[model samples]
Target chain A: MANVPKLSDPQSELLDKVDVFIFDCDGVIWRGDSLIDGIAETLERLRKAGKKMFFVTNNSTKSRAGYKKKFDGLGLTDVPAEEIFSSSFAAAAYLEQSNFPTDGSKKVYVIGEVGIGEELDLIGIPHLGGPADNDKVANMGSGGRLEVDPDVGAVIVGFDRDVNYYKIQYAQLCINEGDAEFIATNLDAVTHLTDAQEWAGNGSMVGAIRGCTGQEPTVVGKPSPLMIEYLESKYGMDRSRICMVGDRLDTDVLFGTDNGLKSLLVLSGVTSEEKLLSPDNSITPDFYADDINAFFASETATV
Target chain B: MANVPKLSDPQSELLDKVDVFIFDCDGVIWRGDSLIDGIAETLERLRKAGKKMFFVTNNSTKSRAGYKKKFDGLGLTDVPAEEIFSSSFAAAAYLEQSNFPTDGSKKVYVIGEVGIGEELDLIGIPHLGGPADNDKVANMGSGGRLEVDPDVGAVIVGFDRDVNYYKIQYAQLCINEGDAEFIATNLDAVTHLTDAQEWAGNGSMVGAIRGCTGQEPTVVGKPSPLMIEYLESKYGMDRSRICMVGDRLDTDVLFGTDNGLKSLLVLSGVTSEEKLLSPDNSITPDFYADDINAFFASETATV
Candidate 1:
């Protein structure tokens, strides 16, 4: 029994020790479309207390700008686009920082949604595939090769509702035959489709490509130091004063601890309390709470 | 260096020691639609010598009858439909032997091609989702649950060029939530699209479902003894008199050795001599040949 502190009061000493708060959107702020109980008010309170807040999500289906619209739709209008860091944006940022091919001689072959394309477009990187290739099917019956675009220098894979055999085969060909670099936006296994259901995530799509190519992709999501390193270099934030809050033990909590920051686990999303307290569980969070609502719970309430 | 005997003479002692010859189709007999030179004549001679033969292919894209068509097309008209054993047919055979839900109570859900569906139809097993679900897309934007057919008792995944996210997600839902059994036809990493090209196989599609469900499937392909055990019981063959021949070291040679049978490697397809003789390679074949044609080459020619 690890004695993990429960942050049940607004004036908890752990809250005063942190100057910056990083939150995961799906489970912490909202599950699917609906907002979490008092998460909006909790953010406003934290903002009033002079704490800087940023939302980091592994969902690559949306860019940072797209995530801003989602926040607004959930009535969290105060959350700005600049404070959001999505895996889609991280992939583009990673490529831009690494000096990826900028010339028209080579382009990225995307096996994902439009958000990845939009992010690449913002960075002025030429790319093809994505939603456009969703309906495409390979002519396997013809006993001919699927034409590999010689200009493809990289294959960026992310979450896609329209993932098909064409994209999987094309990505495999690009990486195995075209000698293209493989990049994955995230590797989260299952994602919340709604408050009660879980669906296959981008990791499943990436696994298919990995199976055939027999190569591992450079993952750019949580638990990977890519995004956090970008945030540190861009904002110059002190790692010791930053606290990460999320519902997943593998991605959210591991991301914070692996980067030498504090993490808080919430029981509102995918992970249940029983799973966290299980004897075999090794990922220990700095703090645990019923939900983000517990952060502002009255001191007179249950300890 | 380990001594792996090279078979060059038709009167090699190894040939007389074996009564049954199980061959892999793509690389041993042919590469794509083009049959290897003298392979048809070699089979005819082997039959004349009273050696029983069977074509065992991990290619689940076609059923036994479909493979017979390919054999006839390649001028191997003496090869009967019963002699062809495809992974698709093996999947159905595996389920039938296990006495899978024979009544109308539950059905198998297929995440593969028409071949798998056809094989299931042959065994009088009701199934859905194969080529029929190829064009289906998940309504991910709505954040609604993808309907899981409660009638699905098992999910049989094989090679499918029409594999899409809908099938992956649907299979995941059925296996994880609906408690359906997971069955994989084969786990071969790649398959020949043409002699010059290779594409992602059913293993990659199976990998996607395994990724989300976190479950291992009962693989019914090469290297697994399920098909070999079925053959042994059905035909009452002696294991000591069986020889497995193929081009791959992982599936073909491993399959034979794992099942206590002599294995022969042919260099007409994927594995090259360098790879086979590599110091780090652990899978050693009982015999190696340049191609099937080398089996009948004159002893005085080179060896």
Candidate 2:
């Protein structure tokens, strides 16, 4: 029932008006490690046409520098570190902007992976309990109490493959007992682990802490204005001239439309045409396309 | 503001009318490993008065045999294993009654401790992924797709000390992608790990899966009526004559009142006098007592 238009033409008026294009990397640019067809050339065309590019991803498992390495590995060698905005980097940026305590007096308790910790380190925010506490088990026997460190000012929960009971319990204790700020890099329920299947995302880990603490985390990812606010503040970009392009509706499209940016939904990833056109689908993107390659399809066809 | 009367006298009419007492172990009989004062004498007195006692605990970490061992270690040598009804046992009983596959055509995937697995094994319900999967990390690297076992018919989530990302992901895959039944032992948010502190309970673990699957689990523990249904079916006890005694308001008190059983709230566990008296407290027990010891306080005083 959605009245979204298909962006088939390379010279579409919507594409012409957009000064900046904010893209979600995993689904839009590539599916797993394989880059989408014509995406590299489309980016080259967009850049030649004087459009600013920013790759925004809710994946908190990798830092901006780490993301740059992934980009390089994936043959997107020109994608600068400054243009890559990961949820982990946004978390660190949000904390820095909020004037969070960076000294040894107070630190962050990470319920995530190395990426979040690495970003925190970049911002000079002291932290503990990420990969370091992954193997640590809770002593539930006699005289077993998870000791709460008095120095934890915030608990940053992100996508962690190493998430366990000890980290979950420790995060819960820090938030409930220690009165630490609860922050989630993203609340994405599931993410595509590969081209084959979807896996549990950071939201699952955040849900555990939220369950015990009876608290809502300040989400620093897409659909949450925190990441956009960070981007806008850092780059001074015009929101009206920016178009957000991605595959997912709940995070990517909602992130764009909610924040006053135009959104384009691509069918090359998790979502399909049936899903987009479904009556039950609440979120409607401004524009729909077969894929990001649709941007410069005419030129590619002519070639 | 609750009009619950104090059960101060042994000759109280409510105590005399009850034939069976369903007690929650953690906050009712003991705090951690240390037994509450006079609980032993209280149980003995109740037994002498021809009252049947059953300890119903949401703690899924221990099986019935394990609980019996703990009871004997705590000097309650007379307490039998048959009288102990843990959530883990309730889960097995529920599955067996429901006629779940036990001939190995389909098995259960446990997102809990050994207790749940042990109970499943007792009922001849084949299961996998408990403490054995504790050290197993999810392969988030290339070609990392969580291989869902085709034999998994149900995913049972309990209070697991060894809960990890791999187990959580596998359970989600089983329920979401594999069409397996989602079952939770209990959903208690926080439990008394010690008298000094409350730790994240089974609900926290359940919450993580709930987040990813977007599915409500069939809870088998307190207040769900599943445990009582299992108990009633097994023991043929009259619900009206049974009194549920526990320290917690949500699980124990709610379980009793919801199941048409007389409820007694003990102040010795998680719920304090201030909490019980608060207008915010919605759950109201039929009677309140200092502890189970209050049952024969006058006799103890004389001694």
Candidate 3:
């Protein structure tokens, strides 16, 4: 129950300790379509200082290329598609690293958007069953027998806007009846898009499939250690030298703390200082800032 | 810990104690349009012997009228619509009995099918927002803003073929933003429509809404005290003298045992005798029969 320290001024000593910094997008670096002020400069400065950097996001609605497009739109010249590690990309990377059969027979049944399809396509994992017609009246099957493709070896659940009974039924059927691996992008309770509204996250869809099949899936996003493990092996980043910087507590903060990396929380998006400092809250960030810009306000790079 | 006695002959002693008999339809009386042999005769004999009868089913896809239609097709002349207590009817009956203000403004946001809609209409509780077009491509909102109607005082979840992200989003928005009563028709894990395939039941939909909103809804169907309490209060049925008979142990048997009523398990449906005799299983029925007809095949009911 220690008090969460708020770094109003730049803490160069803490910043200097990290070999690699994983930044969460949306709130920390950008909001929707707009980049946060001084973030572009901070990334450039950090890169010039020989500090390795990557953007880790739970947003599975977009693929790595799609995230790169957003970074490009923000005029981030150095950050390419490889630097962005989204849940979508993580899902794809997981399949490839697991060596999920290179034989032409195996495929993935996707219950998500184009981002999931794009990511799977990037890794040469042929996927089917994305964006099915979810019209309620039209989908009333006579026997309720879901068609399961023999080629589908895994079922990937992400933030599906078209998450319907048909998709869930098919997903559950594939997982329950067949020897298919069940994987989820994230298990966020509610996704904060704006200050006013919190929409149903991919957890709802994943939870529905879970409820139907009475089975748990391997979550591939934040706090799961799958993405962190990916980064650790791919970049060969030391756990002690890596820092996770983000805005959310459950996803971003827990992702860092659970994986032995330091977590830095910003008040720019979801978490307020009051809740962060509350006694009941167990998940706490190592350091807090008003925003990503505030974190490095008066710091000179170690280089 | 006790043995669930498999009754090959009539157990007149157990049947003699109960004044009312409640039957679960699908597995007990009929299995998808094909009536179980001698079930109609069993109902008629039970009715002739002065034992009151009612049908309690978790299938929310049918309204009371729709259920009556199926009953009529099966030549169940004695079983009126009033005797059928479906989860849909239970949801409406609970709302109506609670006097969920009939004043033209307050309504329920239904995330279910036409059956639930019909039942709510029968009770005169107006509803909106069900099974909307949730095609992932078209549903991307600017701020994840859900269109919550101010007049919606409650959100009812049931077996929905069109259970989609849009309906879930609206239901979550209404529950999170407003003081709306969250109600679920049932929470069956997997509704076995046929012997080979099991469809995702109302539990999946309810759990999705629960996952999105982080709020548990009041379940009105089997095993929940809502239906038992409704039946008890409405019929003034004696708890000790009432019997719940069904094939499944989870819904029907649990519904009885959880309450004070005696539970009778029929083996002609889902549960095998080995499971009933399993030492690991804690849920035990008061009596067991091969089928409904077998229960009354050899003896006369106590008048």
Candidate 4:
């Protein structure tokens, strides 16, 4: 058998060429509520080394302002708001630039809370369902009234607390009857939190509609070209020089691998060693590290 | 607008009689960590009313034993292990019965964990990726230097944490190179936890591979006729009398709609109101309730 190169034993030479370090929060920096070991020191050390580092988190729960507060609380004050990228921001920016057909009367049915809803408003997209909207609806099989907005033009799938069967059914009817385009904030199926385990991300919601309508959605989050394009436009870095680091392989590593960038998988969060060794792996990281501190200390100077 | 018939509205009196009550676990009974209010009491009430209720969660994370423990913890002690139906069990039973082209020497690349993996082992399917097997090497990725089992017959997709790009690429290669049939445990896009959000279910993982290989998978989960058939065979109930209850409209409600059964959507979980009103709505539930308890208490009982 030929000696095929495994990522675990990276030729040591490929490790030195990274220029931009894209860090995924939640898993790499902090799992849920607490910071990973030596993550703050790792960021400071990387900043001192003059590496162009940015925080790329797919979590849409918090806005950039919230992230800034989280970073400051975690002792990562060097990075500014502009250096942080979130799916919420990317979704908003993509909507702004996207040439999808929209009518002044057309409504964007949003399923998210303040952050995602606010982003749609900021982009001048008209939305239908929200806290104040009287013409509210819910999915079928959920035991809610199906209030169909006949004038709806698009369905934007986001995270929400009050989702129901009536809501899903109404969304389906719109797609089937209105021929509306669909967009999801992200394809992440689950979000990892501080205290609890993982929950469904936009992908789950997207899957439901897609399965029913047989239409794929235009995703605008991590690993999606939209988020990456937004980041590249702002950061002015070649895609090849950027590396995506996180604890889970599907989102972070898959994002990096899909975009032809290096992925570094850390063992400090959601994914375990048993998963890494499974035969059904769909995402493979370019590099594997114990923690961000070790990755920064060992690979920073080399890169 | 002429009174639009609200299929999900309990007050609409769409369902006058109850036949079979199918339940999904994640959001309807409980969101992530705890049970939704009034679920046990409602189930008990419905049980006392002599309704045929079956707990049918699509989550492949746990087995019958695991779900039994969870249901017992919730104090719904009326159900037995035989009542639960998981995707893994469905896949295992299907593979066991359908004379799938396994020559005993044919290698099987298992993409999921214990739920799916253990089932394959129990069915005498030769696994290729474990430590003990070298003759038929199984890995997450399809492209590799290892001895590609010449007798490889099928590529399986399951809920795997170790999934990576290489694994998908490898699976694609195996299918293209060896002409192996592609099979998936389920097409769930997200799995829910109580407190956290959703995680990428097997659907997205399969999508990544399908994007490359241009091959669709043979799915074995809810909404798949195989599962419905298996249930019908085991339970001996008329398919028309079954009512599927879940949080998301895409899977649970759609399953019912597609199979000519009644579907109920619960607000205690993933599907949201905005989604139902969106132009893209597809899967409309037959009925809706704030939660399972409300279904029985409200007009859902007679309607």
Candidate 5:
């Protein structure tokens, strides 16, 4: 609840204490298919300064391997697949953590794309009800009824391009049984892709199931503390030494501030400094800068 | 929000004043393919008493012609297609009321089945977007981006069995254009067909677009005054002489009470007298019966 500090120049004095740096991918490091100016160089310098790096994203449409390819496609070198944590992978990890039946007996009725399917496959979890044969179910009975898969013990939803009434019907029936676990990748309403306009995000699919079933999902994406929790458990990183940087205050900044981590807002993506300082927004960052490059430029001046 | 009256047996005095009887089909007339016993005879007697008959339903998946076919399949006699006021048809009527361009220059982007498409076609209203190419759009780009048709001036949603991300994405963009009218058939959360479990209704699809775009739709189904407005304007129905008969409270009964029309609740399908009279529920009907047969049994006594 502290007043947002003016981030004219970030000091290495603050960076020297940071052991882990979590970067939001889409708006922080890159915009559309291009990287922000001087961001790659800034990451390189941060790496040389012994700062551990992790890329966290709420985009559940891609798997970790796919994210790695996206990183490689953008010429972001030295980032292995393990260093990337996507919401789709976070959902897989959440199910695995909850011991979703891996005995080959129970399966997760997935309502997402291949990204969610791949993550579940990597974690040795069985799944059914994917994006395959969407039209077959679409043209079914008047009520859009489908036979129940008795083996479905969980219902997981992400960014499903093939979201149909059949999937919502089946998922509602499964979750309404009162035993299946419901998990959502994120609740991001709109995703900003180019500069044209905003598009509906994964939450539309997640919310469709929620609206039908009236059941709350355990969200596993940004600002949920699941990604940071995964990083802590996997790498044993101290929360106090972690610094979060991103363009959105709701997801990236809120994720850091809510967890006692230093959060910075960059103006390269969705939100702006004027909007953040506006009376309508309650979420505020500890610091603000033009972009990651601008934030890093201040670090060089301090050095 | 008045307290629900305890209705044991309806008075024939109320029936004597009734001229137009609006019945909800799914639960009141029949429960999925079988007519309630003696209901056809009751309709015959009512028609003999000079009462006009109309069927109003929130089931948007079927066109009025399709509803007539369904009525014939159930062996219900003497019902015409013009007397059927379905949500799909109502949506068409609503657009026609608004003077939506019929010049073929303006189009309605539909995110529903052929039922909705057929109604628009019958009215000679130009429209695009049907369930035929659902999968083609489903397998399009990863982000499910479709070029916004410049001619689209309205977006209509009903019970779309083929509700995909592309439909929602395109619909959201069209509605976000600030000039396109957003219309939903009904916002029923779940469609109860066989009573085994809950299946998602049009509300699931409508709510998805609402959640994504933060826009409210002009609902045209039960509980909305648009249906009553349509009947009043088209058939010149007198509200005082109209009686709405249905099994559900929130939709069928509320629609009647909201407009000062006498409401009757039957217990054959969804809402029970126990639930209606419960302190938790606010929607109430002026009369209650075991089923349509029971109501007709009382009518015989009056005769």
Candidate 6:
């Protein structure tokens, strides 16, 4: 376990003394295929100073292996594949701990991409729909998407670029009629990558399904206990001593606040000063800075 | 608005159908204590000619108001109010309209009595606490009831027999919350009578406060638009041509099903076997038969 000191609420007063700098990839390190401002240099400086750091993103649009390749292309070549954590992986870990029905014969319905679907397969939880041999895709077009069938007991929702009415309807039907338990990989309403336009993320879909079924899903990403659970299982991190450094409040700040860990919100992402003032954004950050490099430059103690 | 038919799918198919009987009260005849069953021998003998009927029960408690009153004591004396409808008025209506928040209010922080609280209240919408004022009077000695809080946006529920902690919480903070909405004047959860047993009604209290709010309530009376909205609002109903008849879906089957013309659920109080088996229980009936009295014993016609 890392010998991180326990910081009182007092420690959160300063903006520095953050030894482990975690960056959220999609909106922080890079957006789509392009790197964000000073991101590459920040990573180099943080590493040279012997500070431990990692990139954690809840975006399940790509697999861990895919993220590794993207990072190498972005010139953050020294970052290890092990440092990348995605909500899809967190979801898989959650299912594993939950003793998910993993018999090869049991089919699990997935409403997401290769990253999410592949995670289910790796964990031995069968995918109900996908291109894999065991997959049982509904292909309901845009209208049948929300139609739920009892045969599908578990629903895995992730970021899908091609969401249409049919998918929503089929998923709704599955949830309302089939009584399928629902899970979303993350709660993001939109991702900054793939252009700056807003797109519905898992939260919007979950809201629609909840409207009909009166069910709230267990989100598997940051801010959700499942992510922390996965981290503990993978690295044996001391739950009380760890801290989360990321940009977004909905994900990173929420993750830290909800789990009792310290959070550092970087100003390099989609969230802004105005958003922090809103009552709906329940979580508050422990520290903030322009980027990873500036964080260490301040050299201010957390307390 | 579409010219949709009001009967349930099964009942709608039998165009000129009228073979049984049922009823619900609250809205059909009287507002609170006033009798809407009316003064007419016209209410009896719908079954003597061999029409089958039985009251569909949603109340779960009470056995036949001991078998009938209100009308018997009010000197509209020819009929029986017990034979009109089951006390599960709110539940039956809600079951039909389990959709979205008609406004933005989601969870109902209820406080009231047995008929208004337990079974019916919990069916679809999530409820935060026990039913209010009236319900306390109804369920004394049962145990400690959950208290209501300001976080609750809507207070729906009814009557009570031993009002105390539950009622205080409801009447004080829950309703006083600025944005909170109050529902329920169907105040009489259980009406005490000449004998030891009590009869339940949602008048008195529900009616009193409604007068103050001036927000004409969506009363779940014997047969109000509220009940019909279940079928018509969702499935579409033909108001001009449809008819309802019963001893009681609430007070009378024909109440909401009546559509301003023929609302009659026959006597023997609530319902009969023929009414239970007929499609109108799910649809709408044209006429009624109380006990052995059939109103249109030898006729085949539309209202």
- What fraction of correct interface contacts does each candidate retain? 0.58, 0.55, 0.55, 0.00, 0.47, 0.00
Query: Interface RMSD for each candidate model?
Result: 1.9, 1.5, 2.3, 13.6, 3.4, 23.8
Per-residue lDDT of model 5, residues B1-303, tens digit only: 436554445445456778888999888888877788888888887788788988988888789999999989888848999889999999999999889988887889898888899999998888877686576553243353457788898999888766777788788788876478899998888876545556788878887887787778998887889878887897788899999988888778888899999988888888866787788888778877788766456547777
For candidate 5 chain A, the 10 contiguous residues with the lowest summed lDDT are A133-142
Chain B alone vs. reference chain B, TM-score for every model = 0.92, 0.93, 0.92, 0.77, 0.91, 0.47
Q: Per-residue lDDT of B170-255 in model 4, one digit per residue for the tens?
A: 46557766778788777775443213323345665565446445567888777687767776787787877678888877778888
Q: What DockQ does model 5 achieve?
A: 0.38
Candidate 3: which stretches are off by over 4 Å?
A8-12, A132-144, A192-196, A278-282, A299-303, B8-11, B131-144, B193-196, B278-282, B300-303
Weakest ten-residue segment in model 2 chain A by summed lDDT: A8-17
The candidate that wins on DockQ is 2
> Candidate 2 lDDT, tens digit per residue, A10-35?
47656777988999987799988888
RMSD of each: 3.0, 2.5, 3.0, 16.9, 3.6, 19.2
Flag the better candidate by lDDT, 1 or 5: 1
Ranking by DockQ: 2, 1, 3, 5, 4, 6
Report the backbone clash tally of model 1.
0
Q: Chain B, candidate 1: TM?
A: 0.92
Pairs of residues at least 3 apart in sequence or in different chains that clash in candidate 3: none
Which structure is stronger by TM-score: 1 or 6?
Answer: 1
Q: DockQ, per-model, please? A: 0.57, 0.59, 0.55, 0.03, 0.38, 0.02
CAPRI rating of model 2? medium
Native RMSD of candidate 4 (Å): 16.9
Query: Which CAPRI tier for candidate 4?
Result: incorrect
The TM-score, computed over Cα atoms with residue i paired to residue i, of candidate 1 is 0.92
Tell me what TM-score chain A of model 4 achieves: 0.78
lDDT of 5 at B181: 88
| Error in Å for residue B225 of model 2 | 2.0
Q: Can you write out model 5's per-residue Cα lDDT over A1-303, one digit (the tens) per residue?
A: 336766764655357667888899887889877888888788887788788888988888789998999989888868889878888899999987777877778888888878888999998888888776354453244454467778888888887766777788888778876477898888887876434567787768877887777778999998898777877887888898898988888778889999988888888888877888887889887777788776577557777
How many steric overlaps are in each model, in order? Answer: 0, 0, 0, 75, 0, 111
